[model samples]
Target: MKLIKGTLVALTCAAMLMGCESKKKETSSIDVKDAEVSKNLVLDLSVDKVKNTLGTLKEADSFPRNITKGQKDWNLVGVRDWCSGFWPGVLWYAYELSDDPEIKAGAEKFTAPLKEIAYTPADNHDVGFMVYCSYGNGYRLTGNEEYKTVMLAAADTLATLYNPKVGTILSWPVMVDKIGYNTIIDNMMNLELLFWAAKNGGDKSLYDIADSHAQKSMEHLVRPDYSIYHVALFDEKTGEFTKGITHQGYADESMWARGQGWGIYGFALSYRETGKEEYLDTSIKLADHFIERLPEDGVPYWDFDDPKIPNAPKDASAASLVACGMLELADQVKDNALKVKYTQAAKDLMAKLESKAYFSGDTNQALLLHSTGHLPHNSEIDVPIIYADYYFMEALVRLKKLEDKIAMQ
Candidate 1:
């Protein structure tokens, strides 16, 4: 049996006292449906935005972190940065959408720097973001054998962090205090790399590790209501659960917005790769918990259970991640009612992201806005982030394909 930590008293106290209660107004609204016209409009607008933004970005051997100002200047980060892969990912989506030679070449060039990360050892749990988004998309588009090799190396490195006794991979080996064995919800996203490795004839142990890690996450990181904790701490020697807490969330008991997004996206991908009904069911439950707490607009505050709910900053990246996961979940469900419900939720979220409030104007080169990154540290507050734009574009591209299939039906 699992330890099942987290004091219910703390949860009850946080729920009763946390989350702001305010009815905010939206700047505008658009009805997004599964239609050719609506799909084309969004797709065309996205392609143009991406092309223009890429033009502003300097053509160097690196990736853009975020737009510093109006299209005139941009910030660039090295391959070691956690966000290095998203720039190429957005470019790859552009190539997929338009099939333009310029965009294709740009994607390939930007992805080149990331190949080094595959072989380099990283103790953090974001290797999937670093390698998969860049090399993974590159391989998917071009069938490049080199990209496959890099992915295999990355998967092997990621698997090294797994502790069989703990039943999960270590998320942050070096925390402030570093007293306990820890796993995080974000680690779930990395399992896809392991799943991909096993499927591609790399190693069966990769699949077993991923499966066990996800099962451990479901049992410990997830609360009874399906809201997730940011971290699950374990006793290193006996693998006994010690505590559950949040490193970046507003409070230890609060549900971090981005963590839930990782849970939703990671579990959905797991279900797709393994055909596991339990994973799918867990994803749906998490999605419902997420959707039910959202404000009038589909976007969410940085921390769902934060004390300052209505006044809290919105994390558009989390919204994008969850919206993408919802679309995937909609596709996998056999029940028509569930399929329609989730599909509509996804569309509404996408439409909301494109609204005047969330979408950037000509002033900013970044596509999406109002993302709160590490609010507790007072860093990158209410600014556009690269991953937000990457996942937003991904959701839009996926929505277009879904519309095309609907039209064919």
Candidate 2:
């Protein structure tokens, strides 16, 4: 049965543990409903919504057809690390819910190779979330040495990008003698790699470097409103923030949908790493702004402020990322009212996405509908995105705590 193979796949990375040299803490207390009945009601509603969404994904055959792609069009599972990484996370959540060894195997099968991918010569900053969030979690769940090795190696590679002078990792690759390039908002996700290194690899310097880079981004990349500027120009040798430009958005200052999502979760992560109230405060401010500006359905338009992208559809991937971040923020924040708002907003948004946007016919392709890859870059607009699917499943599992995932359509 496909279910058997699916479960077996997760075994590849099962029984791994997170290696951390330090403990990260946030002092904020979440305002989870104190009344047992009220909390249960909210939890039940969220769980029901999550189950229905997972069901839709299963019915749709949501796993991408081609895991490794040649690039005629887009394949959700383009490569092992690029898109397929989500499978491990999905499997982990599935295993959590069902206690099925098959689900566990699936997560392992997909997560086992993360080290190789991250160490590849072409690796970039997103490697943290791209590799670690999937495989690292697998290692954490299963105590698997291979996945842990990979996670550590990936963290090391990510650290190599650090520019001590500039106090941030050089984001993308550039040609020899080229200059005028810097980090992107998406790179924020990479900090987790450094964090893992500090925790598990006995590398405190890595965390220090990560902290410095994050501070640089906050100083130059994040706007006053907490909206992000995608790409910035930096002095190559000096590594100082030169200027911020809108590389992925309409212009230099426009906030991209995905970029905003990246910032919310990324900054929240920074807060998690260090209990500094400022990061938490910044995260809340951005989350509030994002929630307030969301479209009626809770999914945001491509840009919260820009009007240039023509007929921009709601990005399912952005919504999914934002939801996960919101949930994380909800659990992290101390204020009762704020926690309720963030958690409820996340749930409400996912509920709508689960109901209206998910493709329900094939288990291999279950994803919330209407994702835009990139407009200017023309990557994938209004379609399925693997990261979106990953974060969506992450949100579901985080919310509902369901675990048994069989790859049955």
Candidate 3:
């Protein structure tokens, strides 16, 4: 469980990247709050909400997924569920914020069942979601060797889905027959696992695989306007990109808010890992588009192109994810204007997320409300999703660190 000094330094550097102070220039129209109360209050409230939800789970196998309309309880799922990691991740973040033993115990309990996922090669690309968010954060915070072993195995299992010819990991094996080769914007979030593995005694090629995937995604999934396609199809045999499409968006051409959030966060993290200018550029472009498209409150509708407009369901999840991504992007960008812009955009988004309009409060156990999962399928519409809460807490933690860094300076 003991980390060498090098690994500790790497971890510290990563945290510093997420927590770096923005330039003092006030370029944003949005007023950035300076009070410590605003920062700590939201985080404190989130810890209480997550701890309360943890008390409600009676079954060892159950993990909170979402709360349906008019439903009082979380729709629980098993360890195999893609979202299962977020609840444990939420627990880890809560523990990080409070250093509370009860939350740590709950985090370990929820995270333990997911270790099985590492040993098994997944039929889909979401083993990163199932393992990395749980064991990855666990290992990051606690330096647990068992967690590290699970993450390395999970990363190797995830690597099995990579197609050398296609230059990206296959996102959904179930859809390969129908879609040729499929990669989604969400898969970008999984590359951190491979990058971490490559650095931590796994094959060096794991880094190459992740780097190649990010490059291919940039070439195929990102549009001229820097908006993203939810899915990109390629020839499995020939490794040629066939088409761009959508599975969850309002249309193939419309920007799905959450998918765009994934691109921003994914590319930002990729740039963080590889120090590639192109990746950083892509993240900044996507972020600019997202910021320009947001409503006055800073949260976005489920789809920018959704005909409903003001009537379209607001995706607090998208806002949460983008807020976290923007914080990362803020740290990576050298331009002081961009740094302030992204940092303020993140702050505004978090402000809206913490407001009475978005925060779940006593209305539910989930941290944020009104996340649209897959509207085309009429599923999880305007519900409280676990990943929203996970990223919301993550953004808070990052923002808090930024504040602390500024204070120390």
Q: lDDT per model, in order?
A: 0.80, 0.65, 0.86
Candidate 2: global Cα-lDDT?
A: 0.65
Q: Model 3: per-residue lDDT, tens digit, 1-409?
A: 1112333344344444434554443211111122222335456656766787889897767899999888777999998888989989999998887788888999999999998888987888899888888888889899999899889999999999999999999999988767678999999999999999999988999999999999999999999998999999998889899999999999999999999999999999999999999999999999999988888767899999999888899999999999999999999999999999999999989888877678776676778889999999999999999999999989988987898899999
Residues 102-168, candidate 2, lDDT per residue (tens digit)? 5566566556645566677545666776577677778777788877777777777778878887888
What 10-residue stretch in candidate 2 is worst by lDDT? 26-35
Score residue 113 of candidate 1 by CA lDDT. Answer: 80
In terms of lDDT, the best-performing candidate is 3
How badly does each model clash, as a count of residue pairs? 2, 61, 0
Off by over 4 Å in 1: 1-39, 68-72, 176-179
Which RMSD values do the candidates have, in order? 11.7, 12.3, 9.4
lDDT of 1 by residue, 1-409 (tens): 0111122233333333333331242111111211122334445556666777777667546676765433434578888888888989998998888878888888888888887777877768888888888889989999999999999999998888899998899888776256578999989988999999999968999999999999989889999989998999988778888878998899888889999999988888888888899999999999999999998866899998778778889998888888888888887888999999988988888878887778774446677878888888988788888899899889977887887798899
TM-score of each: 0.88, 0.77, 0.90
Task: Give the TM-score comparing model 2 with the true structure, all chains together.
Answer: 0.77
